[model samples]
Target: MKIERIYLLFYGISFISAHVNAFDPITTTLAVGIGATLGSIFKYFQEHCSSKWISFNSTGLEVDLENKLFGQHIASRIISKAVNGFMNNDNPKKPLVLSLHGWTGTGKNFVSKMIAENIYKEGMHSSFVHVFTSELHFPHASQIEIYKSQLQQWIKGNVTNCAQSMFIFDEMDKMHPGLIDSIKPYLDYYDKLDGVSYRKAIFIFLSNAGGESIIQTALDFWKAGRDREEIGLSDVETALSLSVFNNKKSGLWHTSLIDKNLVDFFVPFLPLEYKHVVQCALAEMEARDLEPDMSIADQVARDLIYFPKSERVFSVTGCKTIISKLDYYV
Candidate 1:
């Protein structure tokens, strides 16, 4: 009887010990899972609630950026690369130039649509990786941190590499000063990056940023001064700068503005496109037409387009370079 009792007690103890051992593992796994879940929640809150996060530069135009700043030759160069040769179906295996322009409502919205709706369906990026973030917003100081982080995972190189993915920043005047300050280094390596990586893209900074800041930049920081402005051009010599960002010569780039600052390349729209843009004004009756000069929109356009620089404070010394290039390169 004593022996039997001892055996029974031993059996009970062994069963309980086995169950406890199994429960140990379950408890450990449960703790780990709970900790992991809390950690993830904390991280998400931190990022989302952060005051400002650095975001990547916008992808492409949501609509057309207009013909005022973006002229035919620039458009042709870009469109050609986009279609690979003006064929209705020409598609490149890699992306093309990054286009930027001044202001909104210039029809810049359609840029990406043309690529995504038209180019992608026809199979443009051949090795066929997915397009991450078909859309993007222009980077602000607020989103720089977040954007830089995202960019690290999505892209491997610097701004010059932005062209590899067809990066463009329209209305660059609004870009944060910090962001512009960061881009100069990247511009220096442009050709090397593009040559080494066929997929490397161009970064076009379209700004309404010019004048005293430009001349000052030319004189001080970049030392691009008179040399950078060149002498042979015609268009910008006498034209009043209509907007802070529009380029008078109207090309995709300020290759002439190279070695200069964003301070240098800005210009205004012409009379040809401003109040004159309203061809229907001719149809108005004499009374209505009498005050056509006084129309609010026209006056605003006039102010924005013809702000005085009588001090000759701002003159476009660079358009000559464009005409010269058009002369030789084309």
Candidate 2:
């Protein structure tokens, strides 16, 4: 049933039921109807337009990035500050658009989860937080047109329901070209589109599209005997965006999302080192309510494969397999 109809039925029933006597047979039937309508109304508001779900805790997000997330000073800082500024703004120019780029296991999805957890009480499972994976959601290249239409409609409908909604597009590197452009209108700086304002919304794109560039930059910093923390956004942001834009394999290749600068921040997640992997294992153990064992954490981190055989400076998988590795050790 439509939300408007549900609302009318709910209020109308409440009025009539108030006047009905407990002894009347009609009261029981009316009571049943009221229960059904109330359920529908509650669900509609919860899934649709409830601001009660969105409560931005900037301090919590900062703490999460500091503790849960490892070896990503650049990503942790950018995400914390970006989210804080956007959430505090009552009138934003446009929806906050963040494009996170890094190799597998570098905490792109993990950071996304932290953001959701700090924003909505339900975190990733929140109805307002929508995640779409390219390989799963848009598998067929032949159905690009259908995917575009469905994508646009889904975004528009959800935004109309709640302006504070969040849409996360995962596996963006695999998304078909031009398919992402369909929602470009929503990301642009417009007060309203079709009378629906999206300024309060947030869009995050996760991809391995610029992994090579990011890895190379990190590798260079290591080779130079420079601290990874010293390697800032300025070092990789331009190259990352360019490489992603020019690379035909990327979803953002030659896309206006880059050309028009619709992407507010291209957050780079640096590859994790051996120490970071150990930290991940230790953190995972604590998450499972187990005492953190340094010896086991070291064993798990050492077992993982690392690159640059001579130096072995970086974990090839960057704590991606830390969980399963922990299972075997513990």
Candidate 3:
């Protein structure tokens, strides 16, 4: 299972060479052919199976955050550092637990995809990656108990199959109050739970729970003429966590996940400014295989709403509606 310990083909070829002198002409040929087939099978498995499929490109991720992701410098830095450190560690004490807090269209889901793409070869479609949206997966409050059992089984089954499996939970704010706590054991420091080790797995929670506090902190910086990039985790993390923990409607409300300090990072995604929205439009145009037209991008950005009535410092929906807005133009 270890990467460096594989010697499938070498051992097979050595065995075939050593035994060839002892066999009849026909038998020798058959033995060699069988050895080669077995060797190929093992080599194929080694190359395509779990753990080996992961190729963490930390440099590539940094470049992506710098070039593709716009406006949320704090999020970009925290995500890069946290994921890089976690991925590089061969024996992590616990799973990497990240709770992304921000308003809609602020790149919570986008960043999740970025992380998945960097870690897994197939990106979001990898068999080991699992995504759960509260609205779709856990819609009924009456089925909380059913959800708890099913969720635990699903996590156990997947992690048992691949230790490095990723579980992304979207719409955490809308999730049932006590629903998430069921999987707290998997996220803990324990090396294994019932023979399955979750230390190498990852858990990402995407929510709008602490968005208000995050926005307030960002707006405070803007009003005081401080650079948006200057706002660090120190400025918003404490408030953000507290806001999410206290909000009764927030999924983690009074939950032990935060109380026990199980959440590794509460990354704050700041609201996008007008310029950032324009950047999103330009990026979208490029994504669509069209030239990056500033005039059209500017028009798309202008059509969207901004906040702080007088100053219009930030986009109300960020780049959430940019694609549709651009569709109207082109």
Candidate 4:
């Protein structure tokens, strides 16, 4: 038997829309019975897969969600700052931990997970994973609706920024103010918040706002005046990196909107130190002796990631860098 296709609906809730079936009563009854059974099976498969998101590649790094929480955190200098900051903050609410990275950088996705994993391992309900950006409640109305309402109220409170956090909004700089406002409760904050793990929760809002956008907007206007001028004598750079296109040139995209205040909201939580961590991680790999067997990109990646107590120190971004950087190390 050939199976044509599989459609999985995780939410399970189905909206059946039917006008009186044009079929006779016996045929209509049969159709209804088949539809209900098919729908339930689809939802079950979707739910089964929804339980995990793993990052595995032949290149060496394996990031499993389970290992991250059960193991102690791995820190680079940037992570060290967060850990130290976490320990020192006696304030009832936790500091909002935010991180920003342009395209080509998976740091937002990578870093935020580590932070939440830390919170959960510290005795927080494993179910609290519900609060993460990749929540399993995706298509669920009741769980998602209730979570959003609580988060909205929490955002309005002016406690620590880590009060029930939001996600790693990909290209937030391109979003409209109206759209920003819709998620305002998730991004901006007021005072006197509660239930947030001021000691644990963090809002990691990543963006290319000031660095990429402002630079391009300025370049666009500068280039306009120079089109009539001769080349090489030009004071402005006319070319753009593909990374820049992936990271910055999203203003025209209807879906790429970010709150203008996102940076300000997250600046306080930004990592204070990364240079030493980057340097140390590099050193750890250099000491490995096996680094000579890899490429430059892999070498760079090797130095970039921190090995958790339960897992290896390889990651997707670092994997490419490892291959590229291998030559230098060898």
Cα lDDT of model 3 by residue, 1-330, tens digit: 433434555576677677677747876887778776766766776524355687888998998899889998999999999999999999999999999999999999999999999998888988888999999999999999999999999999988888889999999999999999999999999977898899999999999999999999999999899999899999999999999999999889998999999999999999999999999999999989999999999999889888998888888898999989999999
Q: Candidate 2 at residue 308, lDDT? A: 90
For residues 1-330, write the lDDT of model 1, one tens digit per residue.
755754565565455445554558775565556556555645653422111221222123223233222322333234434433322322333323333332232223234334433333222232221233212453345776665455444433433223333344555454443333343434332334334442333333444344333333333422333433232113332321332324333322233233243222223221122333222222132224344333533333333222124422222321212223222322
Question: Lowest summed-lDDT stretch of 10 residues in model 3?
Answer: 1-10
Q: Please give the lDDT score at residue 48 for candidate 4.
A: 24
Better of 1 and 3 by TM-score: 3
Ranking by lDDT: 2, 3, 4, 1
**Model 1 TM-score (2 dp):** 0.32
lDDT (10s digit) by residue, model 2, range 200-319: 999999999999999999998888989999999999999999999998988998999889999999999999999999899999999999999999999999898888988888998998
Estimate the TM-score of every prediction: 0.32, 0.89, 0.86, 0.35
Candidate 1 — which residues are off by over 4 angstroms?
A: 1-99, 108-119, 122-153, 157-164, 180-199, 202-234, 237-330
Cα deviation at 219, candidate 1, in Å, is 27
Question: Of 1 and 4, which scores higher on lDDT?
Answer: 4
Candidates in order have lDDT scores of 0.34, 0.91, 0.91, 0.36
Q: Write the per-residue lDDT of candidate 4 for residues 161-260, one digit (tens) a residue.
A: 3233333444434432223233343333433324433333445544444334323433344346642112221212122222222443332122222323
